[model samples]
Target: MEITLVEGDITAQRVDAIVNAANSSLLGGGGVDGAIHRKGGPAILEECRALRASRYRDGLPIGQAVATTGGNLPARWVIHTVGPVFSSGEDRSVLLRDCYANSLQVADVLAASSVAFPLISAGVYGWPVEDAVRQALTVLNAVDPAHVTEARLVLFGADTYTVAERVAAGFS
Candidate 1:
């Protein structure tokens, strides 16, 4: 798979799937979650609500993912994955890794050749941006190329853009 780093709004990406760093509730919280919700429109929340009503528990461990409509975003689908809060400890890394893994799995299942991701849990979740970038690249490298043809790390700021670029370059 090809990896790239770009500075922009993740919600605006034209990939087949765009990931949302969602809360366990899938109800929409701050940071990337809020932005996605805002751009995708209230219909996204309505779908999330329906999922919750159907007994979709928040027990989706960190790293696991579920699919939803893109709402008003350019992408066709939204993959909602719960990421561990940094204070959750080293065990959280496994969940974070699963977050990336499950995301790719969902993308493959959706036949999505291109996917865009925000730095999962790096914002209010307090994951260090540098470490998060490294971990993301590590996980991305582990994915089979047939599963995802293109992946882009969409960053909201210069610092995050720099970190993602450095980590992606290290893989080269």
Candidate 2:
């Protein structure tokens, strides 16, 4: 896919799908999750609540992803994927990597031509910003361009934006 670094809020990006840096529970929490919930309104949470009541697991399997409506955001859909917490150890790297992979897979299945991604595992999840940016780019590079035409890494801060730009520079 064509990976690009853009400074903005992932929650407000107008893509076909936006990857949500969600906790395993998929319940609305802090950071990107909270922002998405806040913007998407209560309907998103209600949907999550109902989904949680069904067959949802507290811990999503690594490399797995699920879809939800955007609620109030401009995007049509939100793809929630669980990233490993910092405490999950070095193996968390692979899980973090899967966070991107599974998200793209979900986008492909949804026939999304474009998608936005936040630096999963970076904020409340405690992944180092630089490392997380690198991991995100690595996963993006592996995605088939045909499946996804455009991919934007939306950053809320200048530092995160710099990291994304640095990673994108290498990719380009």
Please tell me which predicted candidate would have the highest TM-score against the true structure.
1
Residue 117 in candidate 1, Cα distance off native in Å: 0.5
Tens digits of per-residue lDDT for model 2, 1-172 = 7888888889879899999888778888899988998999888888888778886845455557888888989998888888877764455788888889888988998999999998888888788887888888888887785568999888888887987777667764
| TM-scores of all predicted structures | 0.93, 0.91
For model 1, residues 6-70, the per-residue Cα lDDT tens digits are: 89999989999999999988889888999999989998999889888785854455677988999
CA-RMSD of model 2: 1.9
- Tally clashes: model 2: 0
Which pairs clash in model 2? none
Indicate the worst ten consecutive residues by lDDT in candidate 1: 55-64
Q: What is the model-wide C-alpha lDDT for candidate 1? A: 0.87
**lDDT against the true structure, each candidate:** 0.87, 0.84
